[model samples]
Target: NLLHEPVTIASVLSVPTVKENLEYVIHSSASDRLKIDGIGFIGARKVHLYFDPPLVKEVAYEDMSAYPLTENQIILRRRHGYTWRELLGPLKVIGVDTGAGAVKVNGEDGVVVAQVMANINVALSTANTQLANNNKSHSAPAPGASVPAGVGGAGSDFLNDLAEKKKTV
Candidate 1:
């Protein structure tokens, strides 16, 4: 589920990661695989997120119609909460040759490529502004495993505010 927000940092925690052998996870049904600690995106692109403590638990059948994973991939899942800084430790577009600036091919100026990257950086740096906070309520109707550790840092503050907002009559 594309939680009105993105989850980062939690993957870097000291907890060990659990990996899924592709041989075991591939399935004819899309939703069925989602039950097994899978991370999904639009168009049924399924990715395997690291399970905390390096353990893969057998999950019950869930209405994972929400997440449609296409190809199988792996990523470190969030194990703990995070701060604004940690959420965006250091954003960089890899493969950029700093010495030569943007990359170009076959006698083409890299103006367009550079511009696109600049815009992406802007969107990321001010992500809160660029993306709408569709988080209408404190309770995330998201279908999946609950965060291993409760939110902390700035995220904790925001979640607390949302909880308060939810409590207000």
Candidate 2:
């Protein structure tokens, strides 16, 4: 069964806006071939798939069919009529391989995901450090320090209530 090991499908898309894009990793064991005609989010209307990479096949939403060819491979078909430049990024030579002197196209989803996660981790760490510093800087006042009037002083009503509750406990 394919359940014994899971396969990964990685892809990259160039959209008009990054806010509309969703990043996800799905795990499924169903053998039935499934097709995705559109993708939508809650409160957002579904958008038609305009173009897919590599195969660039044009298929109607009604007739589109997709299934995993192997454990790791699935065919990609584009929505009809979208320009190649709109689906993929602008056709510019990004790099040249000096060793083989050949051009190669590779998907960057894995690298993009890794970089995003690293950025999130760094942000979380920075926020936690700032919170800890704030907490340390605003510690309780010294025993003889003057607490303002109506504040929680030694004879404050709040402290008296707590003392009364502690006696009953």
Candidate 3:
């Protein structure tokens, strides 16, 4: 079963794209008849898959109807009120440059490509830093402490006072 299998960070980083990583996970695991509840790509490299219980014998790649493989890429099924067609437009395209170890997303503006593992690491680090900062800012303050003033606070206070006066009149 995937839950029992050892999927290290290094193993996850080796795959170039989210799709490929997910495929690798499904292929490598002992369980054959697995149902994927959900999947997500965090940063660029991290691929998360949610599965239901009662693991059954292994199912072949062809037998998995949900994942349809094409010559170049795997077209994901639309789910959770979000479709790849809607987000990436009708011509949703992702290209993998194996030589460069990069994955490119074709966008309206231009194609964006980055070194897969390295880019994901950087993005994850940045996200961690931002989260840390947010947590620190939201930590409980000392007793009798006043909340720090933020941008537009005075303007909002003035508007609220004006509304209160109007209500009184």
Candidate 4:
């Protein structure tokens, strides 16, 4: 399954703007990849999302038709990173190295329901978890630090949370 393979950053792209020119280049690249590998690169497409009452708006509007979400997104001139936490879902996949000319079955096999072999890394979730844990530990007070009697002080709560996380981790 996908969980079996080591996750790594597969590729990176720099887009100065979400204008039509950039979108055209992205589409052309996907088409080229499809022609060469017989596998479509759906992750290469980009969408321009425009909304009215642009800031602090309750609703959003899209100018494009329904389409699959991109692997990632970048704002025109804002932060360089784009992450989607709500769309996150666990995956189970297995990769076959066709170069070996032999197959190894780890488990049951059936007709493929859906598959995508884009240039993407699956480690984003794990990496994010590690980072969050690190931040929590760094902010936590020492284990033996004194805590107030009446209320659960931040130190005790932090240590308790840390211990719980350690057990789960």
Best-performing candidate as measured by lDDT: 3
Lowest summed-lDDT stretch of 10 residues in model 2?
109-118
lDDT of 3 by residue, 51-70 (tens): 11111112212223322222
Error of 1 at 142 (Å): 8.7
- Candidate 2 Cα errors over 4 Å, as ranges: 1-69, 72-103, 106-115, 119-121, 135-169
Q: Candidates' lDDT values, in order?
A: 0.28, 0.29, 0.30, 0.28
Candidate 1 residue lDDT tens string, 37-142:
2222324322222211122322322223333334232222212221111222121111211122333221221111111012244445356532444532233312
Model 1 weakest 10-residue run by lDDT: 109-118
Weakest 10 consecutive residues of candidate 4 by summed lDDT: 28-37
Tell me the spans in candidate 1 whose CA falls farther than 4 Å from its real position: 1-150
Q: Which stretches of candidate 4 lie over 4 Å from their true place?
A: 1-7, 20-60, 66-169
Candidate with the larger lDDT of 1 and 4? 4
Candidate 1, lDDT over the whole model: 0.28
RMSD of each: 21.9, 20.7, 19.5, 20.9
- Residue 15's lDDT within candidate 3 is 36
RMSD of 3: 19.5
Evaluate model 4: give its TM-score.
0.16
Ranking by lDDT: 3, 2, 4, 1
- Give the lDDT of residue 36 in candidate 2: 27
